[model samples]
Target: MRLPRSRRRSETRDVASDKSEATSQTSLPGDQQAAGAARRFLRTALAQWSDSGLPEAARLGERLLDDSTLLVSELVTNAVVHAGTTVELVCRLDTRESPPGLVVEVSDHHPTRALRDDSGVLDESDVPDDSREGGRGLQLVAALSDAWGISYRRDRKTVWCRFDLPAGDGATPLLSLRGEPPAELIAPVPPQADRANDQEWAGRGALSFLAEASDLLAGQLDEDNVASLAAQLLVPRIADWCAVWVYPAGAGARLPSVWHVEERRIDGLRSVLEKSPPAADKRPGARHIAWPATPGDTVGGGALAVPLLVTGRCQGTLLLGRAGPLGLPDEVTGLVEDFARRVALAMGAARQYARQAMISTVLQRGLLPPAVGRIPGIDHAVVYEPLAGDWVGGDFYDLFPAGDGRWCFALGDVCGNGPEAASLAGVARPVLRLLAREGYGVCDVLDRLNKALADEAAAALTGGTAAWEGGQARFLSLLYGEITPYAPERGAHCTLASAGHPLPLVLGSDGRVREAASPQILLGISETAQYTSESFDLSSGDSLLCVTDGVTERRRGQRQFDDDDGLATVFGDCTGLGAAGIAERIRHAVHAYDSAPPADDLAVLVLQAR
Candidate 1:
């Protein structure tokens, strides 16, 4: 099987010649459609190279090809979603190296939208929450590629990943072309070193440590979690030991988390820190604390304590200790202080959100009707589901007695969500009740409310007061009605006024559903907006249903839950059910239409003549 010397050298040269470089570039629009096109173009180009007798083609197995296509798809999709500009993709096969490599570079014109962490891999700490739908794209790219990185220019940014091809005979296998190995290939085990070295303080290692620390801090909202994560990030990275002390509002300081590279020495270190003298000023600042050069403590060079200041208040203190002769460097000190600042900010936000959520809950409960009171000869049921978050929604419903033998009910939706919407609902609910108690009819009550809202809006537009700035005025759709019991033969009569709200559905005892009133202009839009009342008779066992648009507009993927025909069908199915039964049926159906939590507030009111 031995070959001649000249023939062997000729074969080697042929293989090396095949390693010559080839590159292909294409520009695509920044949109969802471009992802598929970019994938197709990449596959086509790679196939052409395979057919050209390139030596690297033999190593392009199915797994590698599929991974390349997937990475291309993810990167293109990221560009489309985040950049929103023309994207340029350059794929290059560099046969110049022994094993050769394929470099895929995706560039966008948006420099400001560059990735937060230069490290291509996005770990759990980088994402805001576990339930987040997006942000896993970069993680996929890092997993599939042998190496990846981000580069920035003045007006553009490029994300590049490299895939190495297996070497041919007489060709040496090249290591990863990029300096850093893939994050997945790196072992999860912590470093064995008890102390950080000068080498670990430079370049990618230091930068990566800081980036990961930032991500961890950003992801956590709880003060205890933030403190623990902050301590964990400092230990085995910049310090031999770390301890965090938190000072809650109107409470004394407490140590929540302590970490040390040597697990056995953690208790001793904690004791030393606790017994140590307090800092000179004890105010919100950072400084170095001197420790005695004892036997076990000789290696522990010095300690630095930095205050966690949030909104000009000292919330906590972060203490760190390093080993060996080197005192903390200026750069390291600055990095530690920056980390403390991030922790403080996160803690502040978490506390503020909790406070706001509690306030909103209390206010919402106060604004809503406590219970649906029993009106003579009337049976009713109401359902309210607020949007999932730490804020109240704009939807509101109330049923109360107006006067003798009359019960007034209202269902309305403000134009927005959150605290502003809740405030407006608070004002509207009481105003409606006051007007009704003053003996105003349905039409008269709506007219007065509309005029009041319009005047407020006009005053806000004219800068009448600072309190009326921004969201002082808002639009709302309302369905207001008063029910009065007649005689045993007639049952009850309902007088209703519709102000741009969804038409009320009247479910007849014989299984027919019809609109109770026509729509009108929404309140607060026009000063001259006219509203009129319509009268309807509710026979025994007949139910009137009023709802906010949240019920009708609920979506399953791309399709809505209830159009006109669908609503009618839903009503038709509830023919023999009582008011409470019918409301439950509709609520359950709306929830079943989509697996995801509803994005809007839902409110439903069902009143039946008994």
Candidate 2:
């Protein structure tokens, strides 16, 4: 099949002409098709440029081909999908002294236009699972391309992309249109000619963007902050225009709820659902619909609704949409879902704080005794820590001024925790304070409290025999103390009463520690239970420390407690630290002894003779 010389040259010229024509034809497509074709064509063009060996452009050609082509595709895509029209793409093979690359621009006829909003475009609810048909296109382009956007004109809009192709001796581009680019855009010089540096550069850039996004999300604190973070992450990363809403854990199927929004209106977005809510419900708290917008109409276009959910519960929904069909990618959707969970946790914390504040107010007012009856030379400071649980625990301390110059005080822990225990303390506190002021000793006060509790228990179950037998019975442990400050000639005397409770620690001015004298039966155990009170003399600078089981019984391991020995070590090792210091040491010791933070309410009362 030998041919004549003329025919052979003609064949060679035809082949060359065909390749040139193919390359030229790659540049001429409608905007939509051009963007897609550009991506496909660029990948192919990179391979061809590498093999065909334009040694100079080929030396830096791979890098230029990858970055320039990707940016070209993005600009073309944005111009086609968002700004509207078949764009004009211009790519100049730029070669100057320093290095070489490409300059690309895609222009469409649209002057007055809108930009992607700062919020995300993926509807929280419209995220598709891994086995789905679409998503993640523009997001990928945003990740890969260096810069992409649209420019305005009197008769048209020009979408443009600029890729700073790095300068590597083997494959990086140093400069193209002008001289050397700034240091930031300059590519690193290649270490080896055989190595493919451009692919590595692209990979590193993508990874850097992802790392930045991860760091941004890691530092968030509250639920609202999470939504805001999601919005921040999604906006240029995905499409634009995002909104997120979260429901309280118990807010299912309820209106007048809390929600977060980036944009308030998506005309017809709401009406579509209002007109057909049941149909929307089929997707389980999510719905998506898109319709083209006619000129002058606010409704229609791209729209998506997604649910913020955890454990199969619909906590809230996310609404995202744009005027055109900008695909909602799964990566963006997954990000929003993750942010939704954090938002839920943050809201839960806020709710707990509000609850704690309310209970604190009610319990503090209801439980502490009225002002001391003008007792002389007696000062008091009380501290109470509630268990970190559903309700505040029953721990109370009080100093009542009994008309003389002496003050009577008591500190006690009710058995169990929560409102029931707190209620018992509420009933017993004022009564015991009044009885002590009326000249009753510790034993008499105990007797009065026990009888009153029994009577109240009986009254609480007025319904039936069953209610009286099991429902209305409650028991408690208590400790009470009183002090009489003495003048210089007299040592102040102190008295304490314990019932089925830990001994209170007493620190003498001479650096000695001792337990309260005697212990007795807990309140509500035996109606006729006898109580004993121990008296000790307090010198100037001497102090008494009273506490509940919360300090001693804090669990450190599976079956370990910071027991009496631990408490003794804390009090005995006291190093001239005053009352406040001793209290602080005990608190610190408890914190250290426990494997985790102490879980129960802790109450401490300290008295130092002036």
The global C-alpha lDDT for each of the candidates, from Candidate 1 onward, is: 0.73, 0.55
- Which candidate has the highest TM-score of all? 1
The list of candidate 1 runs beyond 4 A from truth reads 1-104, 109-199, 260-286, 290-302, 322-330, 373-376, 461-473, 485-491, 556-559, 595-597
Alpha-carbon runs more than 4 Å astray in model 2: 1-239, 245-301, 305-317, 326-357, 360-383, 437-439, 457-473, 488-490, 557-564
lDDT of 1 by residue, 1-610 (tens): 1122222210001111223366788999987567666766776677666667766765665445546666776677677776789999988786665456776778888876332344443444532332344223565555556666666677777777767775543121122211221221221224434234434343223433443355456666677888887787777656777888877777766777888877787887777667653432336656897655323655447778898887678777888876644366676777778778888887777777667878988988976886866677888899898888738989999999988778999999988888888888889999999999999999999999999988888877687653243454488899999999775435799999889898899999999999999989999999898899999899998999999988988888878877656766897899889989999998998988889988899999999887
Worst 10 residues of 2 by lDDT: 9-18
Pairs in clash, predicted candidate 1: 19-95
Give the alpha carbon lDDT tens digit for every residue of 369-420 in model 2.
6654433443334556777654667777787765465567777777666776
Q: Score candidate 1 by TM-score against the native.
A: 0.68
